[model samples]
Target: MAVGDPTVRTTPAVNETGEGTSTILQTRDLRKEFGGLTATDDVDLAVEESELRCLIGPNGAGKSTFLNLITGRLEPTAGSIYYDRFDITGLPSHERVDRGISMKFQVPSLYEEFTVRQNLRIPLQRAVESDVFEARTRELLDQFDLLTEIDEPATSLSHGQQQRLEIAMAMGLEPKLMLLDEPVAGLSVEETAEIADILQTIQAKEGVAFIVIEHDIDFVEMIADRVTVLDQGGIFTEGTIEEVTSNPDVKRIYLGEDD
Candidate 1:
């Protein structure tokens, strides 16, 4: 379906307590540190079944570190995380994936020498429990307009194409919550727009909630239903795009006065 099409139900909205009937993911006072430096500090966030939340911050603001802590790539120094109400703070990355959380990094991860179709097969193999693996893969390929490139070596695709491929692979898992870190990083304006369109389309149709970490305000504004800003490892401010953009403190600390 097209981006923002009302018919496709990707995720359910938050309930009365600002939580999903089935809270897909949650973090309570989550913190991460490296030696003397703190990367994430007391982060408390929640993602309902299919809510699209954008996390934005300046460089060194700990966006990546926070994502690592959630996905089990890095252990949190303190606090806890929950997936479907089950504690997952100590779970390994692979185990979390098996539990229904998937992440797509800013850098495209794929088998460069393998054809796009071959690259896709790896995830499909892992998704054996998914009844519609093949069909889902086909749909993802079509969604990204990469069906023709299925037979071409992944290394042969352009940077933009590679980005799309990585997203497609992540979607193949049918994740309950998708963590996308800078999915549009390094792409041209046009390329970013294309990827943005695909993301919007996926959310509308599949109800796959997303926690997108990005520096591109324009892009985040276009995709995020709500925006959260991080500064110096702490939540700086949060609100609608307009509210956050207009906040004087957010401007001074995160966006820069002139931004």
Candidate 2:
């Protein structure tokens, strides 16, 4: 499809003040380079409040580079990142988390030696008041459907269960924006569906925006409010799942089809 197809959505139009009123994250000319190679080109993107946006691309297309830049794992060589209307391009990763930005890497980050209850308490202890910490931990456990295994060691649970525990811990922070890198990377179909349901429910009830980098097309269709395709280190196209999936250019570039 043509780049400007009316049915296909592109970047949001910046207001006179240079930010969308509803946008939770915005990047201007975001770029990253290492040695002689440019991993991310000048890419301008915006994610709105409570939006479930998916980022997909072929390997070496710069999806990881862009995510690292947003989460402050890697500082951009050029451009600025704005979160909640403030410039956060130079902030450190931990500061970003403290400021309501959280990430769940592909590998689950759980305390393997701790019980489910103990793992959940790690983040809640730091964020919730002691008076309500126990109650809040229970709430998160129930939400993630881990109440039954609350006392089980992390290493004893199935892989999917461990993934759930990590997510529950991240939610303890009450983040405004959640960055998930291949959240359903390794799991049975049933487990993947459960993750999709949990994400949708949380977004609906909590109003947290999500920027997910995933290769699972089915899961992307299941959770994405919008889809962004990255190619050659920049945005190739973006639109609703249907519009993006049907675009000939996207299919050719993303699926490696040749004329």
Candidate 3:
């Protein structure tokens, strides 16, 4: 059995219909402190295979810190991280990616001067054989709806297109799990809705698990299979969207509502 607070089991690892599932990621007493300021406070999180989980919190709730720790961008002060039954606490960022963990940051990290094709080609070349590159790139472009701008410079695309392009590049790694930080930030309502649709399609078709951190409630409702709420660097509560949103305490803590 995986470690951590045994009380924090895979109850939330169920599908939308409430069928129990296995965990793909587990963190046991994961913690990080900067001097005396604790950033991640003994967080124990479990994400099931192909599940789309959302992590939400007010500013300073340590959402970014938790992600950094999981991605190996920062070392944890205490605790261990497990991915698919393997301890990955000490792996570097690149090694984590090599192990099928990919992250897309808040900002679109694209090659601004490179065409969409070129940007996608970069990672595809590294992940797949040259003989399969053309087929895989074509598939990614079609899946991301970026075929229209395949030859355009990444910077010339709209904010939403740029986001999609970046996601496509990350997908080039053929990851089993992906971490996305505020993917719809600054996008228009239509763009946001489109992004939500794209993510759902990808998750359903490819069975890739996603851990998304977003402040956009509507987008979260659209794509999340389960929701995890954080407060003061620790997991305050986790459940379905309805369960989390309807909790009086969650409203008070997450939305600053008066009791």
For candidate 2, the lDDT comes to 0.87
Query: What Cα-based lDDT does every candidate model obtain?
Result: 0.84, 0.87, 0.88
Can you write out model 3's per-residue Cα lDDT over 4-87, one digit (the tens) per residue? 547655532122213333778888899999999998999989888899999998999999899999899999999988886567
Q: Candidate 3: worst 10 consecutive residues by lDDT? A: 12-21
- Misplaced by over 4 Å in model 1 are 1-22, 129-133
lDDT of 2 by residue, 1-259 (tens): 8854678653332331134288888888999989989889999898889999999999988998898898899999999888885688899998898889888887678888999999888878767788998788888889888989989899999988888888888898889999888888888899999999999999999999999999999999999999999998999999999999988898898866655
TM-score, prediction 2? 0.90
**All candidates: TM-score:** 0.88, 0.90, 0.90
Ranking by TM-score: 3, 2, 1
lDDT of 1 by residue, 187-222 (tens): 999999998888888888888889999888889988
Candidate 2 regions with alpha-carbon error over 4 angstroms: 1-20, 256-259
Error of 2 at 87 (Å): 0.4
**lDDT for position 57 in model 3:** 89
Given candidate 1, what's the lDDT at residue 147? 91
Clashing residue pairs found in predicted model 2: none
